[model samples]
Target chain A: MYHLISDIIRQSEENECVFWEIVQQADADERGVSKEESFETMRKMYQAMREADEHYDPKVRSASGMAGGAGQLLHEYNETGENICGDFVGKVMEKAIKMGESNACMHRIVAAPTAGSCGVIPAVFLVAEEMLHLSEDQMVEAMYVSAGIGSVIAENASLAGASGGCQAEIGSASAMAAGGLAYLQGGDAGQIADAAAFALKNMLGLACDPVGGLVEVPCIKRNVAGAVNALTSAQLAMAGIKSAIPADEVIDAMRRIGNEMPSNIKETSLGGLATSPTAQKRIV
Target chain B: MNIFDVVGPVMVGPSSSHTAGAVRIGYIARKLLAEQPRKVQINLYGSFLATGEGHGTKKAIVAGLLGMQTDDERIPMAFELAKQQGVDVSFGEANLKDAHPNTAQLILQGISGQTIEVVGQSVGGSRINIASIDGIETNFSGDYPTLVVHNQDGPGYVSAVSTLLTEQGINIAYMQLYRSNRGGDAVMVAECDQEVPQHVMERLKQVDGIGKVTYLGMMGDE
Candidate 1:
């Protein structure tokens, strides 16, 4: 219901709890649905996200035969026990890859802001849940935090690659995940906002150039990177780091950057890696 | 934009606007027809026409016409499923004037020889706008329990429909009326907060000057 992050923060201040304020806003916006019912719906979504990760079959290729097996490869690599990111972050990467690959294969996924960036939020939340021993209710509350941040981004900027760029898609998603992760780690509203701002600020100029006009190459791997970025940004916020710019201003910058982005790179598959020699050779 | 708009829409997709939204357009078309489509011609427009094949928009449309939800895993086999279900499907391109990039015009013929043409636009994030029905301009997103009432252009129809909905205990979330000329045919689209029951639809069809009443229940899951 609140169109701006500043508005959400103000309302949270009034309510004395960011999570409840977001849930109350969601309840009002849904028209007659109570907060509990809204949370129940979110819980179902969380369940679906978890199921998508657990049921991922890396062997299954996409219908276009452009993507598949990469998630399994990542899983195997993580299993070698040589990953420098450690088991927790390695698992986040693994789930992100699985979710992105699943989406390319037309598997059921929750569009955390969008389908192309679906993996980031789920990957981050699932890993946080396991690593921190957070309860399902806590994860659901964290999703409310993510939803509030994402709605602000959607209203102020764009979430579609065609309209903005990968910056809006994956970048907004990483911000959402980062904010949610900060909340899960018991960060205050200011810290959560900082996490989101930091995550988005780092990804401002990212392009959306899916090779072959498919959400396969670069899209899947980009999701993995977004997940890690969310994790790192959350850790930074939890450690009392602040973004030089406010969260709302960072989102405004994202909107301006998205508006100035050339059409060729904004999901046209006509620029960036989409036009690379290797991608060009495989285009036919 | 609600929380679900951000965190959910649980869908099967390579792309939400291309695949999930395309399926929704076809699904809404089928519901408006109120029966299984015997023959359907889908006309893709702009970006949909340029990249729909790779995104499986064609298959998604067929799947939607067959009553498949957005998350249905059978989408890849939509063509085979349509063949098995005896639904004839064809595709082409359309030059829609002043329409969104992701638009599709579906011409469907029901088994009883009833035909309906729907021009719909998938406006990203699996959200859609049903722009026109049977060439008449009207707008309603398939997000609610919608009633599309075609009637003679007059004063009493809106009040009458409103009364009927009130009697049925259904609250109208939004209502819009459009007509070509006075006393000519008019379309009134009413999106209700509650689902319009079949009995209410039957009663609305019997209203004087009301030509056609089509009720599209809440679109099941994204």
Candidate 2:
């Protein structure tokens, strides 16, 4: 029998999360501070998370919300030669539309380990790459580290919100992204692990309950959140703040919270914003 | 040495059940035909048939026939590319009994006038099993070098076959001997650590119980 766990970790490296961890370790060593020293790092990340939350001003002024078609934005940025952030975000959103367009795409789009969350890693990684001028090798390495962390969470906790809750879904994605970022930004394997655990722990008990089963609504928005959380966690870990709570303890909390959450808050589309009168009316 | 034991696949995905699974079904169908197909027909069954179109099932089938992996981003353009590569495609429906919901039947015709029928299912994450071929019951996952032989049930057939492999220095990773009954229809699936030699195949055909010998080679390796 094949060892599925080993295969998953190997594939995660093939996908580049492992090398990302290496970069983080290098940076952490350069700073002469352990990732554990950044114990209060998560609190600062929370503030960044709040700031990120406010950035999605999805209106006419907000390029993120333009309805004429966001698809053109990526191509437009690529043509205009602005920062790839605009181009990258546009690409992520375009992938989301393409994903919705065909069912047999078989992209295995990593969901909160979910399919929708697939873009989150790419989004944050792309941003980091552009900002830090990291090489493709570094990005690939980070992805492997991220994959390792994600696979562990998948094995020990749950990536499916239905199984554990949104905490597992988006939270897991955030954690994996954080681990990836931390690794890329110069944290050690242990610090990378801590950063990941901290990210997931902070977001534990998030609900799914997408207003529509369609991968729109909160799905796209959550991608933004996942990206921001990952970067924030990396920054905190690099700053030497460690999560006081153990990673395993946080996973347990996520599971317990998920169990306590009603099914409506899962993927059932029964509660939360999914059941709002406006959301019900908007159902296609 | 099951076919699934060796090969790992990469796939595109919203859901593996919906997307990657469909693509694997198509890829195997194309490979079974021996020649790149001129026209392909697919029948979706159960949940696969029901929600396939929504999940890009049709696109996946076309992509698979063109030898694309599930994770390959080219799946969306599979049809246009297949046309460029001189393959035609169509779809229909079929219901299989007690099968996984993600299942399909593919009937393919090569430019050489040869036809192949394949029944398969996508279990999850783009993994699939080739359930049957040409109304004959067969089980194959495209992971190994397999020789699927249909023969008459006779005494000492197993020993003869094993002896031949031993003589040839071929390691029999797995030998499954299946027979309908005594002196009746029988089939032996020999999955090997390496490809079986043509001489070995010829020797197996000369055995008393052997009737037909078809070397499937490696699944999906053109």
Candidate 3:
């Protein structure tokens, strides 16, 4: 009986390693592809984003954008008063905030299908496509890559903001975003994994700490950061840089870190923003 | 395991009880009817009634009737989409006794001249509990092979029904028997591991103390 248990444990560890190997080995742009094929893939992603964007309510969109510290910046960009990239960043932030607010209100909204990190993926990919004039298929391919990275994080670490804090929600989102960016930029699968791993590692130990236990407050602002971080990490990986730890190892570390984090720092909102003097004055 | 215990990875948003559960209740209510409802009236109770407007609870119900999931991006525009699909919907509020907070009662008139009253609650994370059908107070969670029998309350009604199930080689996983009074009205709900045979239902309906035997039927994909 003991042998059977030990065998099961060994198999589990081996499976985990194998999963990491698969991620570390994939390359979105490992080899030369026909120009037409590349274009088709880009087109598909753009199409999905557009379709998905239409499903998002304008009210929710506006809310997310405002809350992400992007409302004014986006408005400035719309009027050509801000740099293009800065404006884009602001818009992404705004959308993230709106998503948080909507979730707090218990709105029947689609998460793309993730409510907590809803703003990050769409804001990054959709905005990038518009700015760069990328095709839909390309964007969709990146999204698929992001999904793989997200699954790894979910399996090895946690996606529940309450479990690990905002780090899990926004950090995981950033990792997914980083993978998407690297994949889109023609990086190999290993590079994409490396980028994702690095991005998550950077933001490990961040707290949830949303004010008033609402998905608003820092939640919205963090999503914008998540998007930016994803893009940056992806760029780094495309440049052939690697994270200090492998993707799987980083995920395990995140899990351990989460386990050690105080419960107040998680989504319970008992610490950080929740306990801030200003927040206390407003709610209590 | 109870179906509720199994949380599948659907393409749905977060908060399965709030969003996904509400959609399922609407879907079940639609399926239970003979056809698509021409006119629908929904009454939200307690928390559902209080915050439903903001949560898109109203839209979700309409969307579910129109055959949409909570994860569907088009849930927000469900009202417009429903109109295009020719479904008329209205919403109201009700106070329910001994009911879950996030509960709604729907009165649907199908285009095929059929009508059904559906009362259900969205428990959380998009999960729902169906409370009753057509005034028959039942406790079936829309899982398993459910037998919902609307009958008069009298002696031997339960035993007679149990005997039929035993004879048919079907084991009841759980049973909830509710009635207003001993000699008044009653509803018998049976959750079974296997489907009940047609002959058994017929026998139960013919029993001396039985009034009406209606099988609420099976739920959809888990």
Candidate 4:
């Protein structure tokens, strides 16, 4: 029901509460569930996301043979104290790959918005568990923030690659993650809104070009980028940076741009990297 | 859109449109048959054919026919599962004119001699539409509790079905009716707010002019 992030923010301010409370109450109203029931549902979702990451099986390969041991490789690299990214981020990147690989291998995954972009929020939460020592309740609160932002994107733009391209899928995930990250770090509603806006605007017009029409190739790696992008946006917002355009306007732009995008790049796998010379050779 | 629609629908993945959505089409096809499927022929059209192999659309569909949910870990091994369950499954490329790229047609034969043909489209974000059932032009997304009623075209057929639903205290959310020709075969697609009970469906079948009443009550949780 919250079509704009500003709406959620305004409601939160008026109610003297955090963003998740506003979103959670709205969920309660929409579903006709009690507040406790709605939060319980969200808590179960967070648990499922965590479980998907914790139970990742690196031994299993995707049917296409493209994504399996990469998460293991990243994990080993993160442990060596030799990675280019920080230890926390390296671990986050590691989880992102594992979750997406689990998805490809047909293991259970919480498709936050969509299955292909499933890794971003879980990656952030996984790293938060090990590094920041967040509790289950705190993580569930952050999930509400992400869900709120994702709801807006789903309504205004899209969460399907076929509809708006990767910009809508991974792009929406990044924004949702950014808002959640901002919430976890105790940023105000404006900061959370700016973080989501910053993340989404950065990924505007990104294409959904998986090789051979599979959610591998660039798709798996894009989850990593989305997780990393969310982190950057959250950090910028906490540092008081604001998006030039409002968050709602950015989402509207995503809708217009997605409509303007051709079907080839919109998950048809006919163009973009899906048709690249090297990508063509790698198609399963 | 529901907030849950944004956050999660815990499922097996890769491509929601190709993989999870394919599983749903298979699941619905199984439900429509109203019995265990002894044999199923799944025909993929457009992108479902061009790249369905990589997406494991065949396996996903087979898993669905085997009564597996979208998040079932056995999805990758659906072919094996189908064989173990003694269900005959076959796949072929289809040319569904004017259908969406991610479409599948399933011809199902049940254990008790029941049969139904279903054409469904994976219309992105893991949602699907049962566009055709048994050569009849019907369109409905399985997002609600639904009833697919087959009846001879009569003045009171629609009222008869709605009256039964009304008797059960079930509110109708959406309804669509289709018939091949006037005064011939007709179908009424009713999506309800409450689950349509089995006895109500049985009673509907016994009603005058009504043929078969197939129901789909609630979706996505599984």
Candidate 1 falls in which docking quality class?
medium
Please write out the lDDT profile of model 3 over residues B1-222, one tens digit for every residue: 111111122323334444566777787777667367798998888756654553456777887777665556676677898789788898888657877877889999888777878899876334567788877676667666777776788777778778888887889999998887766778888888778766787877777667656553554422
- lDDT of each residue in B1-222, candidate 1, tens digit only: 677877878888788999999989989899999898899999999888887877888999889988888888899899999999899999999768978888999999998888889999998789899999878888889888999999999989999999989998999999999897888989999999998888888888899899888879874522
Q: Once superposed on the true structure, which residue ranges of model 3 sit more than 4 Å away at CA?
A: A1-48, A52-73, A78-113, A131-133, A162-164, A209-214, A259-284, B1-17, B29-54, B57-222
1 against 3, candidate with superior DockQ: 1
Cα lDDT tens digits, model 2, B69-142, are: 76677887787898899887878878568876667888888888878777888764445777776656677776
**lDDT by residue (tens digit), candidate 2, A58-87:** 221211121213334533555676645565
Question: How does each model score on lDDT?
Answer: 0.89, 0.61, 0.64, 0.88
- Of the two candidates 3 and 4, the one with more favorable DockQ, higher being better, is 4
TM-score of chain A of each: 0.97, 0.65, 0.73, 0.97
Candidate 4 at residue A199, lDDT?
Answer: 95
Ranking by DockQ: 4, 1, 2, 3
True contacts kept of each: 0.79, 0.25, 0.05, 0.88
Q: Kindly report which residue stretches of model 4 are placed more than 4 angstroms away from their true locations once superposed.
A: B219-222
The DockQ of predicted model 4 stands at 0.80
The whole-model C-alpha lDDT of candidate 1 against the native structure comes to 0.89
Q: Which stretches of candidate 1 lie over 4 Å from their true place?
A: A18-21, A24-30, B152-172, B179-185, B203-210, B219-222
Better of 3 and 4 by lDDT: 4
Please give the C-alpha DockQ score of model 3.
0.13
Superior by TM-score: candidate 1 or candidate 3: 1
**Predicted structure 2, TM vs. truth:** 0.67
Candidate with maximal TM-score: 4
